[model samples]
Target: MTTPRPAAPSPTDALPGGLGRRFSWRGRQIAWTAFGDGPPLVFCHGTPWSSWLWAPYARALSAQFTVHLWDMPGYGASSMLPEHDVDLGVQGEAFAALLAHWGDGWGEAPHVVAHDYGGAVSLRAALLHDARYASLCLVDVVALRPWGSPFFRLVRDHAPVFGRLPPAVHRGALEAYVGTASHRGLRDDELEALVVPWLGDAGQAAFYRQIAQADERYTAELEPLLGDLDVPTRVLWGEQDTWIPADRAGRLSAALGHAEARLIPDAGHLIQLDAPVALATELRGWLAEVGAGRR
Candidate 1:
């Protein structure tokens, strides 16, 4: 029997990363959370993941910066209806629109931290849509050309077929695929938290929808102009990131005008789970630079 889905989280409920509020953009509700009292720092997550990926770091950094996190329109606690355009193109616009929604903080430029495909979306917002930022941190991000794993390609080509799989089959594929992102392997709880969002029909269909819409052209449009980005940038990678391969970090750094490609040891693509402390130390340091009015 298909399990009846749980009630959608209300604003009063304790949620993952404590993201209990919503921001409506383009008729879609975007779930978000914020804390601390310093300059604004926004985090953007990539595919099959949500703001929960950054929850630990958000709290760790909360002491010094007002850390903000939100699920994209079709991810996390946000809307995932069939009518919503959750592709990178629309994601970019939604991101820029969210920034506008937070325009009261404009006196201080927000620092944007993006992971995976989020790198492309944030770049599109900053470069094309004219969203400003104090700095940017691209961590295990999908920005350069030739991205998308073979599995990603498979799903992109056959999303409808895969989406129709029996629940057991889809869950199996989801576990196997998402597990590969972290070299150290996830604890039972971590794995469950990540997997639970894509369990039911809405989540399952949205999962395939995003994969089918994953296109290299999104980053392609921003590559030539990477050097023109005026904000300070930091490119970070996991030493053992087999998914994107650590080598791509160097190329991305060079493309961003020689920003150093900092690698965290004993981690993979999902550094947030594999090496939280190391990543946090790096962020605290870099964000310290960003916070000190060092442009």
Candidate 2:
């Protein structure tokens, strides 16, 4: 059966500081936003979160680089595909398509800053396409083995049950899940932005759909290709990250030929929320090291 297209985003869907755009990919609409004007810097966010996570960082870095932020196929403003269509492999393909789409106007090979599940997507994209990125920053990404939290496992095992949860039940669960990602709890507004997208029927279903589709095979497939990357890479982790431990950053760095894995103290998995300034500073330094131009 053919997949149904999602409703196009209206002006109201645009975040406070970023403009939203949509692109077609494998019969699904992917939502993205671009800000500032310089070398391209793409931000890929993680599970139960969307491009909204990058708004503050985008503003901070946009002064120097054109920041591109997107909701992966099943999250945020993007279309919620069938559960099977939201796996890591498909997400990689979607990123590849998005990169090619971006290339038409932003000609430079873009720099990438990916977080959480986005790490797997970014890694697979680079491996499958040899995508010519200037530099890559992975923050609390799920790139190593034995990943996935206890909550993730429970949801994965009972997706159908959880997907049918009432809106209030889902909201409580979402807030609780998001709370675990940061050492310092999110502000009311921060929590609202993160939770809003997963609130209604479609949103709640998409939440469980993503968890159900989680698989290690995607990252496992890229394991052999990890050391073969030629692009400069930096792995960043929150010292207090509970979802994916900080040690995975060290392993990821070693796997990528001794690239440094810098730890941000007093931060957790949601570094963008917990410490946007520190994350932005680190990103600026990485861009400078790679000689990516800034205005």
Candidate 3:
């Protein structure tokens, strides 16, 4: 069962301006891109999502800071072979490696903006891998315990069975699963951008492979170490997040050493799309602190 290496996609193949480059991490070519010249800022996305999640924000903030984004090895526009390890612990190490790979790009500890499971990865990178950040903003992140929707639990227990589903059936399930993330339904094109990575033979298998590999122990291990981090932090959640209830926001902020937790109204788990304007305002305000500190 050899998985042939697929051709790499054009850097700007999907998201406008895209994460237009690659970084080799543990033998996997991770897709990434960066822009601007102000203080550096990096974005880390969560499960079932990719660098596209930050494309628009990257473009808007590029005018103020060098914004960097990348797709995890088993995620969008990156390697998705069945054998690739795409779990949280590995992802954290990869993120740490990705940052180090950039060398002087992080001469100054960069600001980090993370969403969902990306939060866990960034935290691990900092706690275990010695990755430093000027500041951290966690948006509807996956950090607390007892996560995983019923579907996630089902798939986690039987990923191989689900991975073997007919392509059409898998597509429908993916669409429906993703739909739950937004309070307002996503546009067809929007949904396509998020779902496209999990289509076809390789993508479908990779999709379930990631779900199967998802384990909360990665975050649990870092929980007690939360307050040990001295980095400035902000926590945000969509008021209507059905996937990870909004109630977890305050606890997470508290665990992060009295950090602020603000909930955005009318948005669900996918705050970037559900409430872009508000999310942007919050992010800009949060990042502004970093700018002020250096001045």
Return the top candidate by lDDT: 3
Better of 1 and 3 by lDDT: 3
Each model's lDDT comes to 0.85, 0.84, 0.87
Q: Could you give candidate 1's per-residue lDDT for residues 1-295 as a string of tens digits?
A: 9866445433213334467788887789998888876778898999888887887777776776787888898887899987888989999999998898886755877998999978898999999999999899999998888888889899999999999999989999998999999989987667777877787999899999999888888888989989989898999999999879889999998888947789999999999999998998888888776663222
Which pairs clash (backbone N, Cα, C closer than 3 Å) in model 2?
A: none
Better of 1 and 3 by TM-score: 3
How well does candidate 3 match the true structure in TM-score terms? 0.93
lDDT by residue (tens digit), candidate 3, 145-168: 989899999999999999999999
List per-candidate RMSD values in Å.
3.6, 6.0, 5.1
Using all chains and alpha carbons, the TM-scores for the candidates as numbered come to 0.92, 0.92, 0.93
> Per model, how many backbone clashes are there?
0, 0, 2
What lDDT tens digits, residue by residue, belong to model 2 across residues 29-145?
888878787899998888878887777777777778888888888888788756337989889989988899999997678999999989999988998965678888888998889
Report clash pairs, candidate 1: none
